[model samples]
Target: MCQRCEEPERPEEERYLIEVLDQIRENGWCVQGVLGTGSRPSWAYTAGLTAQGLPELVVTGLLPHHAARLLNAAAEQTLHTGPPVPGEQWLLPRLPKLEIVQLSAPAAHLHIAVCCYGAGIEARQLVYADSAGRFPWSPQYNSGRGGQPVLGVRHA
Candidate 1:
């Protein structure tokens, strides 16, 4: 099931998120769905990463209250699953100061624009305005039917 839509799509972002999460598991972290549609929302699994890793939810096109509810649900589920792997130790000890911009074309809006630094603590300032152009990260998204690796190291 999709976090945005109740029914799943052919090429669902949730699946991609899961795949990336699996990669994280092999490399340095673990990811599981935290919130979505259904009797048992999909996000029950990801609560453990909040302490040890960067566990977050992307809530687009939802009201502030609804988003809060989803977040709370995710937290409760996380607590139910188990505590973080390394307790208070974070995966990315030296997190970079970064900003994220999300564009909603039809609305001509830049619905989400925020900046944050460090691990787990994000100071968000959501801006609502028409976007000037495609966001910087847009180029990183592959339009291919097959979800190929964006960057792969070649052996000599």
Candidate 2:
């Protein structure tokens, strides 16, 4: 299940909510609840962001096989490894010092950041909720001799 976090003041917000629910249904993830009660006051969503800054794909009562399949998919998409570019910077804090790489001609410039928690495990998974809109950007560093710091648009 995926949560679409939002303030509910905009038209697109409402539309996105509908789409999220529809996608959950299509994915076969059960609908948990709209609002959360008890200790937390916010609406309860099947999927949501944890206190840590990572996306949560909440799954409840799934068979072991299904759970394994989902987890396997997540594991497969770990950061793509490459060398650091001459002047690119990595902004994702939780991620390990970035290994930037520069591509050849014809290809658009590419910047990749890998989470450096462990051998390959991410310390925390980034949560992407519908209501939340989007996650904050990671701060990046310029890679010049006296590289300037380029703050990411998103906060830590």
**Of the candidates shown, which would achieve the greatest TM-score relative to the real structure?**
1
39: Cα error in model 1, Å: 31
Instruction: Summarize candidate 1's per-residue lDDT along 102-128 as a digit string, tens digits.
Output: 212211111111111123232111111
How large is the C-alpha RMSD of every model relative to the true structure?
17.6, 18.4
Predicted structure with the largest lDDT when compared to the true one: 1
Candidate 2 per-residue lDDT, tens place, 58-138, comes to 211233343334333432232232222233434432322332222121111111011111122112221221122222222
In model 2, the runs with Cα more than 4 Å from the true position are 1-10, 29-72, 75-156
* lDDT of the structure predicted as candidate 2: 0.27
Q: TM-score, each model?
A: 0.24, 0.20
Question: How high is the CA lDDT of each candidate model?
Answer: 0.29, 0.27
